[model samples]
Target: MKKNVFYVLMLFFVFTACNREDMQNNPGNIEVVQKDPLTAKEINEKINETIKTKGRFSWKESSDHFIWSTIFQGNKIASIGFGSSFDRNLDSNNKAIEAEILKVIEQYEGKTERILLSSDQYLNQIDVAIEKQETVIALRKMKNIRYLEPADYRYFENEQKLGKSSSGSSGCGFESTALSASDYTTVTPNAKAPWSFTKHNIINAWSYSSGAGVTIGVIDSGVSPEQTLLGSSFNNGLSSGRTISKNGVYVDSIWPWSTGYDGPNDQCGHGTSMASAAAAPRNNQGQPVGVAYNSNLVTYRAASNVVLDGYHEQNGVKIAFTELGNNNNVKIISMSMGHIFSVGKIEDGVKYAYSKGKLIFCAGGTSTSFTNFVGVIFPAWMSETQAITGVKENTSNQKCDVCHSGAEIDFTYQMERASGNSIPVLSYYNGQTDYVGGSSVATASTAGIAALVWSKNPTWTRDQVLNKMRQSATYYPTPNSDYGYGNINVLQAVQ
Candidate 1:
């Protein structure tokens, strides 16, 4: 018995020493931490110190051990309460204590070390945890975890909605096509690709003069690899080449998803169109440039389609894209498709990118789709934290303002309205055809601009780029709901 007691005491001392060392490394800095060690028996004492400390979170000892509850002030972690165990039998008040503990835990709950391993790394461990029902969600409810932001709360709501709206299927069956007139202009000698530089001034201009020697990622309906315009887009500033697409989440893997029908096969033309805007080569031998003409292109096909009313079936696409964004090399992601219903947890992907210092550009809603001016669209909506809302106009005398009418404006760009009198470019879909217009094109334009901005200031953070766009916008044009912030001037952004 005496020996056992000695063992416990030694362990207590060892634990205390470790805690002291941890404090040195991470002082929690809310208050002044003196030279004191924390013992297993004295964890309560540490909680008391936390409470009295000047930091945001405070803590105290409770009747039971091994459990802790936190207090907060206006979403800030204010204090914590510690206990011996989470077992209800051990501490009759465990139920109440657990509830309070859950709050504190949520605040600090981010990607944990246990879950940080590679996708295959600890797959079994994750599976085992899943079998035991030990979810990150449940962990979040524990007093031991960290906090959840308001954004996180919103994500949680969106996640629940996913269960109701999602059908377990990939968005396949996209009718493939070559870049036609609708996709690009004839700039080069025989360029038929939608994103040819010679035809479209802004996009084509960006190709040669913009995105030079830069790398960009397109997360959209799959793009065709062999298109003349895109063939050499990813090539090192030379005339023509290719970037190998390796499947998986790591950066080294060129492409994140499997070579779906969309892979190098932009069936819907959305992916190919966006790519053209970002980096179509100037085969015209003139200055029809892209923002990053010399830049490299990386593609990730995440969203797949299914038969859902008015839904574009892009959740899987966004999720897959998020996984790829984990790679540090993928700095910018351009998504031009999304669903109208706000998927809350979808923002989690955006948050992950934000944490990794990645910039995400997604298309705003299409005008023909809906009139509900509130609630952002997927990826764009999910990226409430870092999204650049798209605004467009056909007329030349145009300007946007997102500040005074911050409710709507994020940024604006020019759009070529489809002429009713002329034959619209034919884009076929599931045996039916409809003319695609509105925010989709606008989004493609903004994405191209973003590529240019990134190429000019490769060092800027997503926030920095966003602020520059917001502050530098010629706002006096009187912001409108449609044209949030004014037009995106690549030259101005670079300056």
Candidate 2:
């Protein structure tokens, strides 16, 4: 018992003192982590796998496909491409590439539905029926297309690693994603602060324009339209439970009963929070205000299954972006999702969207706390997408161990010193108020600020909009891997 207690205390100290964003002072490719000492080196040596790189997702389909990632046993496949080098020219060429990908998928054989894993149904894990239907929807109900991603295996590895949580955690929980508030001061309408928030400076920029006439696309789980504070343009100007359907299949849903879907629809409540952060219009009394109050929201429900493998998740996201880019309803797109393995077509989609004058902002998923966490994730690491890290109020410019800032622990760490004292991203949760903390939340916050800047500089080219934002960053002239040209200064960017 005493030894176990000691072990727990030691772990606490290691994690508490360790910076969550720690990494080699390199600028990219965080996927190649130094192999953990606990990992069995010899166990990896015996495989003589042969794989034909025929299927796009062959890596997950069979061990034979696994051969593509490894030569004999030692060097494994690391990170994939980000849209970082993705250019306007590439964006212009995206449509053709998308057409090719769809054409390729069409050559496959069935309307088959494959179900690999499901989150405990008690949580909001999105309906498998809905997820399966989406692939059908994406393929345009091609009765003959055999683009099935239901049971592929490779995508399940990482998720399987996280199947269990150390302590009390929710279904979509990651211990690293845990919200802490030890030293935070409570925020309220009458609340005063020792210092102003870096992101909140966009409020001052609002004097110039309040993100009017801009459509911010949230490419995640669909938003809860019932949240009146969120004020979605879809349902009577309120983000609420009004479902939209086609062929009797609900594509966008805020409520499951009417939609014929079960399982917690926004299981993690992640999508709703992101949407709210980007543009929660009717800020309730004593609650936080979103960056873009007047902007409209268009949610592309991409993350249909909470516990899906990468093939399913990435394909869903790609389809979502394709639709969003094609329609051109939104000016800015915010994606707070990331993973190591990336689908090439998705990067193409991002460049294509950017070329079409859409702004893409993504979460830089690496946190310093874990020893191996470094660099950035796909999509976010892509050039067309602005990779955003977190900047806690007091921790700015210090390279603090967080989503972005380095080595300077500030109000963020302080917030977790006590309960109710937090520096979390406050947004809509299903239809209620909820808060979360992570680099993903930071991405959403950045999305809101970008809307503010885009609104003020209406008619600027996509590259021009991004450049103005880059110039307005605190680091301005110089760009650092940690802060990425420093925090987004909405006022300076607009002025």
Best by TM-score: 2
**lDDT, residue 33, candidate 2:** 33
My TM-score estimates for the predictions, one after another, are: 0.51, 0.58
Tens-digit lDDT track of model 1 for 1-495? 999999999999998887753332231411322322223224423432443462212111221111211111011111121234212234455445444444323333422333121111101110010111112223333443232211101111122244422322222332433332453454444323333122224443343335543456777655554454454333433335434242322121122222223233554455554555555554443222344455566765444321111111223443455565567676666666654333322444555455566666766544221123323445465434333443223432232121011234466554433332111122323211122333444555566566666666777777777766555454634544544556655556656
Candidate 2 structure quality by residue, lDDT tens digits, 1-495? 999999999999898567333321112312323232222222222211111122112323333223222311212211122212333233343344333333422333222332212221111111122221122223322222222222222333422354521212121431122233322223333211112233445546766866777778777665554444444333322223332211111133322222242222353556766765666543223234456766777776565433223334544565566566766657888887764334444655676677677888887653422212334556676767877765444444443244433221111111111232333343443233445555566677677777777788778767787788777766667666455576666788677
Q: Worst lDDT window (10 residues) for model 1?
A: 122-131
Per-candidate clashes come to 67, 51
Off by over 4 Å in 1: 1-209, 225-228, 232-267, 284-291, 306-315, 367-375, 382-408, 418-436, 476-482
Stretches of candidate 2 off by over 4 Å are 1-151, 154-200, 231-265, 283-285, 304-308, 366-374, 397-432
All-Cα superposition RMSD per candidate: 15.0, 18.0
